[model samples]
Target chain A: MASQTRQWLLTNPPVADIKLSGDDATFSLVTKELPPVGPNQALVKTLYLSNDPAQRTWIQKDQDPERLYLPPVQKDTPMKAFGICEVVQSEAENLKKGDLVLTEANWTEYSVQDAAALRPVQPDPEHGIKPTHFLGSLGFTGMTAYWGLVDVVRTTASDTVVVSGAAGATGSMVVQIAKHLVGCKRIIGIAGSDEKCRWVESLGADTCINYKSKSFKEDLIKATEGYVEVYYDNVGGEILDLMLTRMKRHGRIAACGAISNYNNGNEKQISNWNEVIFNRIEIRGLIVLDAMPKMGEIMETLSKGVKDGKIKMTEESETIVKSKFEDIPSTWMMLFQGGNQGKLITQLV
Target chain B: MASQTRQWLLTNPPVADIKLSGDDATFSLVTKELPPVGPNQALVKTLYLSNDPAQRTWIQKDQDPERLYLPPVQKDTPMKAFGICEVVQSEAENLKKGDLVLTEANWTEYSVQDAAALRPVQPDPEHGIKPTHFLGSLGFTGMTAYWGLVDVVRTTASDTVVVSGAAGATGSMVVQIAKHLVGCKRIIGIAGSDEKCRWVESLGADTCINYKSKSFKEDLIKATEGYVEVYYDNVGGEILDLMLTRMKRHGRIAACGAISNYNNGNEKQISNWNEVIFNRIEIRGLIVLDAMPKMGEIMETLSKGVKDGKIKMTEESETIVKSKFEDIPSTWMMLFQGGNQGKLITQLV
Candidate 1:
């Protein structure tokens, strides 16, 4: 009997200044014989992979990406990402062949992962939840929201939280968590479009402002009423400055990511940081991976919310050619252009 | 008999971008009858008047000099400041004649103040401590150091603390508090000259660096070995930027005062603010007046430390001519040029 395995490879190296384009990229898919798994490792079939803005950070070579939390992905290596996978074969003591797992699996049809790297995913079939929930609400995005709000920003029921990038995976989760769990008095969400703003409002945010509109700063101030107690910042640059000025005395800011400056060669400098001193604000950056110890509590609460219909999970999936594994580069390009809604994934099946 | 009051006034209003000259200033000693003290008020005889860098901010029409901690001195009016005074008459129940007091009195021979405005000072006659200690150690400078280190910075015993302006009143106290009270493992102090650096070391700092030296940054880095956990910032600008780069992850910065930028027309923009976000640093500006509730605790601890010899107190006093009070504008001019040391007090006796 022969074993089955699949792999994706990057054909050409990316140029520093060039924006990823059709001629600049190629993806190659290969079917090869499977190798035996070690005692602590499991063979997993990729179910759902997360396509995050952070992925773009990995593909660009010229940028000095030294994030405190996420390890930078190496060029030409199997793209490292968090995904929900089904265990096809397992020699690990903690996992079974049929068990669903969440792990840092590569962008490929099959992955051989260390059992230690695999987080066992017990599906609550009674609640009718799908495996994709593990990649969104019950996964990294959910955990990021949980730690950034609870631990980093320390948002409370009386806090007025204004979150940017408010309609995406982490932002959406943050809005829901602030509304349902934190019981924040005012939740202002800033998204790129009216559609996203409406989507955020539907997810229990008190109000949603579209950054694409010319009146972003005015709308944000009016929506927040000049009293933002906590700012969950994902989008940096001018948006950050506007938020900094409107922050209340003793306001807390959780600097989760700077998606706005991720691709730009020149990082934006905040002109009014003296506001931090004048207002006596507390601003801290956080990465969810550093808060792994609290994942169990986060998952338990999210799972209960999902079962009770208090939390609504939405994902925008963009499927690309399986053999265009090289198109991973271009697929990621679509994200920076605001081409996709939720998660960007490629299917090999 | 008609009682007389001596007062100094800023006579020559400073023009655009010109240093203040005490010449053209005015001082008057009169035999006019003393004003009657109102209920809840006391007549205080000036003992020692405080002159600080913040006074320069008050002369400017642009800056809102009324800080929560320090009220701004009105132009051409008697120079108001924190002063050590002897109570000559008191209507309020808590105070009595002959008692030493600390209050926001002016540069004058006598000031009628609300009894509520005066804080009774308990003199330590055994150690030869005088009323001036109330202006330096037990006054705003002491409270500034106490609240900034204990509350704003949230320093721990295992942390390393770096204090800029380390030989100044508040900075000196900060170094002592961090070393003696908090038991910080490493305390690096930065001052203007080798003499000031020596003064900082005498205050129990583990190491002291003269910031005026060309190799200041290198010396600072070598002193802490790249582990600065808490930064008690008094002098901002370049020194602050240097500390920002060397701060440990999750470091806390207590922005007590930006003396370096106070006279620079408030136009100095800190170029290294991105470090605040990238390193997850927590920087908070503090006004010691906002920390009044902890005054009793701080006073008791400091008094005990003084008695136990765990803390040492020193004062650099410069007595200006009472007739030369008209030269206050020039005296203040000398402050920014680092002309005076320790507590700059104008004695009207």
Candidate 2:
């Protein structure tokens, strides 16, 4: 049975002198017969997709050359992302037809992937969760928070944790995971606005400070009382420097992402590294892809937490004009402008 | 009998414009009658004093202007140091006269100190170690190596350990301890010359590289084979930069001391910190004074190792003339120039 699949492809790749604008970019949906699944592969139908800031990082032609986190996306290729899918056809042993799965599927209606890349999503009927929950809370973002706090940072109950980009998916998970699992004494969430700050506090943070406010540093210090032991940094730049000053002795900083400096061509350099010597701080940069082996452990912990009502998960939804998968480029552009929040996904059914 | 004691004092302090030379910069030996020991205090006759690079850092006016470590040496006060002392008189319950002890005794022939600051030395009859060993391998330097490797660096037996300043007192002990107790598979020692490299290899390093060689970086790469897992950094600056580039993922760097840039009025700044993020390295700065509480555990390990002949210990001795005590300023000046190896001491007997 031949099946038709539609994928959004980039055309007229941006060059060095070109600026990223609608006039210079195009998104096209190509309809083709679905390819046969290999011996250890499955055919998955896309359900919910994740639009992340990391995607914008790769879309820019002139991103920071010093970015050690993600590799630069090649020209004119299908963009990569995590999406919730249903296994429509399968040749693999573990996955059967109609099995809900999560995988690094392309920005397409249908994807045929190796069984190694696909994780079977066992639906939890008891938690009253949706398939979208697998794309947000029980997904890459949640796992990133778990590994960054537990494995990389080694945060303890006595620690005071401060997280940047606190309203976003990974940052939100970081705040909750640190508070609930690690039993962090104090959690100060730094977000762009007061509404996000309030939302972060709703997730059980001790305090939440608006980074957009003029008194962000003062507020952070007041909230943490000059005792920040673990800094889960998602947005770097001046905020990073500010947090470094307030770090206690033997503090651990997990440099998860530098979203503030990601779009800028030049990287921000820390001026006072002598403080690193004086305070004896340990700073580490991490990538979730590098943390893939611990996926099983992270899932077990997060699933239990979700079931016990310890980890509260939420998503922000935005309705955008949908075309035949050809409007993904425009949808992604809106995301970069902060037009969407939480998990940005387009409904295909 | 009341004893008459003489001690060297920094009589004139260095102001911003004042040169460290000439009559204004004076060291005076004052003959004074000893004061009576109070309860919980002991009068000790200083035997061997330990002169370290960190002492120079304490004298600088600009280094940590707030005096995070300790206040700058006051004019006309006895210089501070760690020394092996013989108890002349004791009013404390734990100590008695004729007992050899180790304490933070000043650079003097005789001084009074609290018994709480002193640890009674138990002579190990099997090893036949000297009293000076308490100031070197079995004392502060030895304990420094123990904590930095085990606790700070968290070295494992499978690690490939690299020690910078490997021929120095603490560095030598670090090499031996990592090789014997930690059971490191490969130990590479970096020293100043071929002779020092040979000395490090003799002390049980699998390989040793001369940092002074023109092709030192190439030699280091060839020697270690790009497999440095734990770097015990005693000398920072360019050597540190070199080590950072080759560090394996999750490598631990024990920033024990930066002897290379310690006395540079303008300290050298590290440029290639991107390697820190790229390799996901953890660099921890350490002070041996902070490791004092673990003295008992450290001694237990060292005593057993020394008794079993698993640890080889050596001390570098450079003796200054007794009259040169007045030239204390110049004597300390020589240390910044790397004029002495192992330990530099002034003889008064």
Candidate 3:
């Protein structure tokens, strides 16, 4: 057994703009004795960690617990993430040694967690599904995109749906779900790069525009035909402001994420706000954990869709970063730097 | 009969700011001979004009007619407003001389409109409902307040509603309705002055905060206790931004008006916008004209409430501007300048 466990701790207050020089000042790498397995608990070794934009929200400084859907990571504590772990020692009947499971763990090499809290990943070897599918398609990423489009806005075949962050995991899931499962009349995507836009279009989106392009505004206007009925907003900021102005009457916005605004307290401003009144728009913020009550129902629908060949979990564009245990902060910084594509995963093993 | 009638014309492209010096450069007062009443038309004398903040939205330049719930007033044309007009001559059987009616008449001494477009005001002497009530409570102003509360967010008695512009027409109306009609549990009001705050409380708001106060942020925090369930926003600016941070789970915003942003393009920015996602907020925009299909139903309910003395159309504090014929631009500008209180009305007669 390893005598010591290495973990990352947040030393400074939260800020998304990471200067690797100053970044080391924000997070600390420390060594601790491996926690002993106790009653109803299992000691596990983390194999992989999911890299996501929402991580920025979890460590927000001084955020009220009542206001946040997720509990904010406190200062000077271990950084939080969902990790695929292998149970090495178990004190519970359901959790056996060598069993692979998914659980919320810290930025540590080893964690002793409640065995009952672990979710057993059921990989479909026949369907070419890997264990990472639990962290990508069938995980928080897929559930968010599925329910956000279905429950948040109820995208229908009669409606035209536009998705921001269309090249990323949640955004790409939303595009595919709206196209294949919901069968929307027109599905448009907004991505950061031309290659990302093309990739989004290839995923059955009717059209995808590069927001980085000089003609993005004009291109979006032409593509939407001045009618954006449903917008699954993964990137908030200037894109959200522009969408507000062009929304058709009774427009619906599914605020899944605000990746653009998740940087160093530099959140963007929405000035064309009065258009909300003029167009009778509806903007609803979505958090996947809030959909827990409907977990079984939505998961059944998702599984059925996948089994029926209606939806693809995600393509093979997953950006998996293999990093040393001490390089956790740098691995996380890449999510904010736009240096990743699709679902960014860190192979902790 | 008066040989000629004076009317205010939009000489320049629309902008919300009205400097009496440069303002006159935007509006031109001209005299024109009365048009003969054609078949199906009635020539009427303007009685009372509703000087509203929404009038600013009507004259916005380069606005797409398809995007606006109300048609944007074009340049080189008479400015548009709802008014109490007395029929002077009628060529249609439903209309007659001396009959008081309501209409979307221009800023003119006289308007020749289709008799079918005129809504006869049924003033109830027993209840003291005057002909102006149609322009105040029973008209667009009252309907906006009533439906914006009833339909926009479906505010219930269990909800705590905070209203902005609590001293203005639609705002005060929202306060009264949320309290008396909707019977909300805790009603909070946001106003420009301590005096306006007091007036809002007098209208049955449980607490009213002056946004201009030095401790406005602390005051709002103390009042809400970080549990704002719903916000009826009429003044959209910094106040709206502040309210966003304290919203409780599943918070709803009735986007009725943005009086603060209706200036010379000095719209305030919302920085802590991620709170929407954190709190799972739902924001919906409202336009009174969009409720036309539900007009008769809502109007009937409003009239019943007034007949039952449950809701006040408005207190006697209606700011009636008895302006001289040429000073139409100055009178209309008072709505934007906060120079008048309550529902600012221009007594054209």
Scored by TM-score, the top model is 3
Candidate 3: TM-score?
0.97
DockQ values, each candidate: 0.26, 0.19, 0.71
User: What is the CA-based DockQ of model 1?
Assistant: 0.26
Q: Which stretches of candidate 3 lie over 4 Å from their true place?
A: A266-268, A313-315, B266-268, B313-315
Residue-level lDDT of model 1, residues A111-146, one tens digit each, is 788999988777766776667667767777788888
Give lDDT tens digits, candidate 2, residues B172-250.
Answer: 8898899999999899999887877887888889988988899998998887775678999887778887787778877
Order of models, best DockQ first: 3, 1, 2
Residue A124 alpha-carbon offset, candidate 3, angstroms = 1.2
Interface CA RMSD, all predictions: 3.8, 4.1, 1.7
Provide the TM-score for each candidate, comma-separated: 0.80, 0.75, 0.97
Clash pairs, model 1 backbone: A26-A326, A27-A326, B22-B330, B40-B115, B41-B115
lDDT (10s digit) by residue, model 3, range A1-349: 6657888887775665644456547678888887677899988989989888888877766667777787788877888899888888889999888888988977889988897889988778766666777787778888999889989887788889999998887888888889888899999999888888888888789999998899999999899896889999988888988888778899999988888887748454888888898899999999998889988888777777777777664545477889889777788888776666678888874
- On a 0 to 100 scale, what is the lDDT of residue B297 in model 3? 90
Compute the TM-score of each model's chain A versus the native chain A and list the values. 0.86, 0.85, 0.95
Question: How many clashing residue pairs appear in each of the predictions shown?
Answer: 5, 0, 0
| lDDT, candidate 3, at A165 | 90
